[model samples]
Target: MSERLKSFIRERATALGFEACRFASASAPWDAGERLAHFVGEGRHGDMGWMETTLERRAHPTAMWPEAKTAVVLGLNYGPEADPLPQMADRSAGYLSVYARGDDYHEVIKGRLKILAGQMAARTGQDVKVFVDTAPLMEKPLAQRAGLGWQGKHTNLLSRRHGNWLFLGSILTTAEIEPDAPEGEHCGSCTACLDACPTAAFPAPFQLDARRCLSYLTIEFAGPWPEEFRVATGSRIYGCDDCLAVCPWNKFASGAREARLHAREALNAPRLADLLALDDPAFRALFAKSPVKRIGRDRFVRNVLYAAGNSGDAGLVEPVGALLGDPDPVVRDAAAWALRRLEAAGLA
Candidate 1:
């Protein structure tokens, strides 16, 4: 009966656009709570105090809900068609992380998860909950346990077929399903992901220091970027994919086919000059459906200024200089930094 139910769920998931689906016993790894306590205790989560706040519930699937007997983990591939490194060579343009180049995955993935959950409940007459990054659920570890993928050295889930470019969504249900064999670590002696990080975000092979990570600094951290990471940010204005892009496993995955995840041409490599000229209204219209919209105009512009400073395009100095009088003090501060960096390079 469990096997038949699993097959039914898999068929429904594939029909719903999920690339892969696997089930795991709805129980946390033995050390999951301890690991969370340590990660939060050391202050590695940075300003994300919510990790500490929800530690009890996030520590285990059963802790969040005792009725959950199975966890359905799903993967959706968003692999880029071409290499992402070449864009960094064009200093005049801003490089957004590939994931943010299209529609927000939270909206895309959550909507799908909700549909799957509804279908599962209807068919089985069981309770279900859906999550897609917005929740405190420990997705990567659970995905690994479900055989969706193993946690790569970079701490993101990496699959033998999808690499690390897959978006993960989870559904917890009271219905029982036979669990799949857990995927074993395949990283071996390779350190490609760890070495690829410009900020050395990984303190160890599988441990990530959120504070030094460019993605966290650009998107999650509020206020101006720390002085130490400003120069390393380069022309990346949204999020960083350095580690994910360099993974050799990506060679096996096909390019992204999900229409909503496809890159918008305008965002691929937007001119830094044009980005600097954007006021609030222009910024919103430009990034209406993209994940970049969540950062808001001030924080988004602050990132643009950081990229402009690292661009080494002396031409950008004037445009960046214009932001000195901008209403947001954060933008003004970033402008000041960009001016000094450009002048130091004798581009002023």
Candidate 2:
């Protein structure tokens, strides 16, 4: 029965275009929970206070849904059609993480997870629950322990087959299911991911300070960016993937098979100058399906202006300057900074 159920889940996952699937026990690691508490109490999560509330549930899957006995971990590959790093070399063009460049993964992956869950329920009349990253579940550790993959020094999961370009999702089931043997680490002695961090966000291997993460700064952070991190931010307008992209193991990753995750032609090399000209309505029309939409118009513009300031493009100054008097102080302030950058760079 264990082998049969495992085979069943693998077939469904591959049919759904998932790159890999593995299973683990539903219980969370107490040491992981303790480390998380220490990390949060040390103020590593930044202003993400919600992480502090779900201590027990976030640490263990059974705490959230008591009936869960097995966890099915799934990964979907979204590697780029080409090298995504060289785009940053342009410096004047803003860079977005390859994973977030197309449609939002939360809705896409969650909808697929639900269908997969439905299929599992049909096979065995058991209760099931699903979670993408939006949930408080300890998905990375669970995936690592489940033999899906090992969490590398940079803390993202790595696999011999899928590498680090995969999006992770979890399904909790009450059915008695067999777990896969956990995978081992291949990071070896490489410190490329650690040295590449622009803000030095990682104090040690396997840990991250969200407060210094560019992804958190450009997206989740609600107020003014700390001036200290501004220069380091450069032209990255969305999530940072330096650590993920630099992993040598990605040599095994194939380009995205799902067309929806394929990089849009318009997004491949967008001009920072053009993006700064967009008002809210323009921003909405352009990024409707994008993860950036969640940050809203004002916040998105704030990020654009930061990129514009780093662009060193003469054309961006006037467009960014036009936002100086906008109602939102955040936009207005960022625009003023962008204008100064244009002048300082002798591009104005």
Candidate 3:
């Protein structure tokens, strides 16, 4: 009966657009709490203080909800149609992480998770709770235990079929279900992800220093970027995908077909000049459904200004210069920094 229910869940998930769905015991297979403790203890999470606040709950699924007995980990692919790294060469245009170029994954994956959750509750008469990257839940480990994928050295889930471009969502339930065999590590000796990082975010395999991660700096981080990372950040305005793109396993992954997950042409390689010009209203309007909107106009433009500074295109100087006196001090500071860099390089 458990096997039948598992089959039913996986079928429904696939039909609902999830590329993969597998189950894991709510207890989790690894010492997730200790691992998290080590990460937080070493100060690797950086300014993401929330991780510290939710440490106890994130230690394990049962810690979040004692009644939960099974975890249904699901993966939704958002693979790019072409290589994203090449766009970095055009420093005048911004490179958005593939995952953020479309509708926010939280909204997209949550809707599907809720639909699947409702179906599961009806089938098993069990209480269900859904999570899509918002919770403190350790999703990658759960996904790995469920056999959806193994955690790559980059610290994101990597599937034989979906690679690293997968968004994870989970349905925790009161139902007792048999868990699937765990996926064995397939990363082998490859260090491509670690070497590809522009910020050297990874101190070692399977460990990430979020402080140096461009994605963290551009998005979660507020205030001016550290001087050291400004040039290395290149033209990436929102998030960086270098580590994910360089993975060897992506050869088995396919481009995303979900209409909502596909990149909007305008966002594919947005002009740095145009991005720097976005006022609050324009920013909101332009990125209404995009994950990039979460950072708000000031932070977003700050990232653009940094990119503009790194861009050897002197033509971008006018836009960067205009923001030097903006209301937001963060924007003003970034503008000043960009101006200095551009002027020193004779690009301003």
Candidate 4:
């Protein structure tokens, strides 16, 4: 009966556009909680204070919901058509992360998850809950437990099938669905991800310090970044994808099947000069359905200013200089810093 139910759920999830669907015993004991606690204890989470607040509840699946007997982990592939690393060489253009280059995955995946969860509930006569990245459900660990993939050295889920470009969504249920075998770590000797990091975000294999991660700094951190990170940020105006792009597993990956997840041409390699001129309205329109919209214009411009500073393009100096008198204090500071960098580069 459990095997039949798992098959039904997998079929439903696949029909709903999920690339991978596997089940795991959510109630099973695991050490993911201990690692999370250690990460928080060391203050590695940086500005994401919510991680601290939800520590206990995020510790275990049962801690969040005692009735969660099974975990249905789903993966949606969002791989790019080719390697994104080469685009960074065009330093005059801002490099938005591959994930943010398309429509927001949260909106895309959450709706499908809800539909799949509803189907599971009807078939098994069980209560169900759906979660995207927003919830503290630790979808990566659950995905690993479900045999979807292993957590690579970069601390991101690595799939032999889909590689590093899978978006995870989970459905927790009250039904005792048969659990698949858990995936084991396959990152034996490769340190390409750690070596590729511009900010050295990984202190050790499988450990990430969010404080130093450019993705966290560019997206989650609100104010002007520390000077070191600003310089290291290069042309990356949004999230960083160096670690993910350098992963060997991506060789087997293919481009996204979902049309909405395809990269927009405007976002792929936007000119730094153009981006530095974005006001609130322009910024909102440009990133209407993108994940980048969450950061707002001020913060987004701040990131652009840093990229402008690193661009070494004299053309961007005028736009960067104009922001010096801008309203947002952070933007003004970034503008000043950008001007100074340009001056140092003999471009101002």
Number of the top-ranking candidate, with TM-score as the measure: 4
In angstroms, the error of model 4 at 205 is: 0.6
Model 3 score (lDDT):
0.91
| Backbone clash numbers for all candidates listed | 0, 1, 0, 0
Cα RMSD (angstroms) for every candidate in the order listed: 1.1, 1.3, 0.9, 0.7
Residue-wise C-alpha lDDT for candidate 1, range 185-281, written one tens digit per residue? 9999989999999999999988888999999999988888878798898898999999999999988877887999989999999999999999999
User: Model 1, poorest ten-residue lDDT window?
Assistant: 27-36
lDDT of candidates 1 onward, in order = 0.90, 0.85, 0.91, 0.94
Residue 161, candidate 3: alpha-carbon lDDT: 89
Comparing 2 and 4 by TM-score, which wins?
4
Query: What is candidate 2's local distance difference test score?
Result: 0.85
TM-score of 4: 0.99
Best by lDDT: 4
Candidate 2 vs 3: which has more TM-score: 3
List where candidate 1 sits over 4 angstroms from the true fold.
none
Displacement of the residue 34 alpha carbon in candidate 1, Å: 1.7
Candidates ranked by lDDT, best first? 4, 3, 1, 2
lDDT of 4 by residue, 1-348 (tens): 988887888898889999999999999999999999999999999989999999998999999999999999999999999999899999999999999999999999999999999888899889999999898788899999999999999999999999999999999999998899999988789999999999999999999999999999999999889999999999998999999999998989999999999999999899988888888999999999999999899999999999999989999889998999999999999999999999998997
Cα shift from native, residue 285, model 4 (Å): 0.6
| TM-score (all chains, Cα) for each model | 0.98, 0.97, 0.98, 0.99
Pick by lDDT: 1 or 4, better one: 4
**Candidate 3 per-residue C-alpha lDDT over 34-145 given as tens digits, one digit per residue, 9 for 90 to 100:** 9899999999888899999999999999999989999999988899987889988898899999998889989988998999999999999999999988888999999889
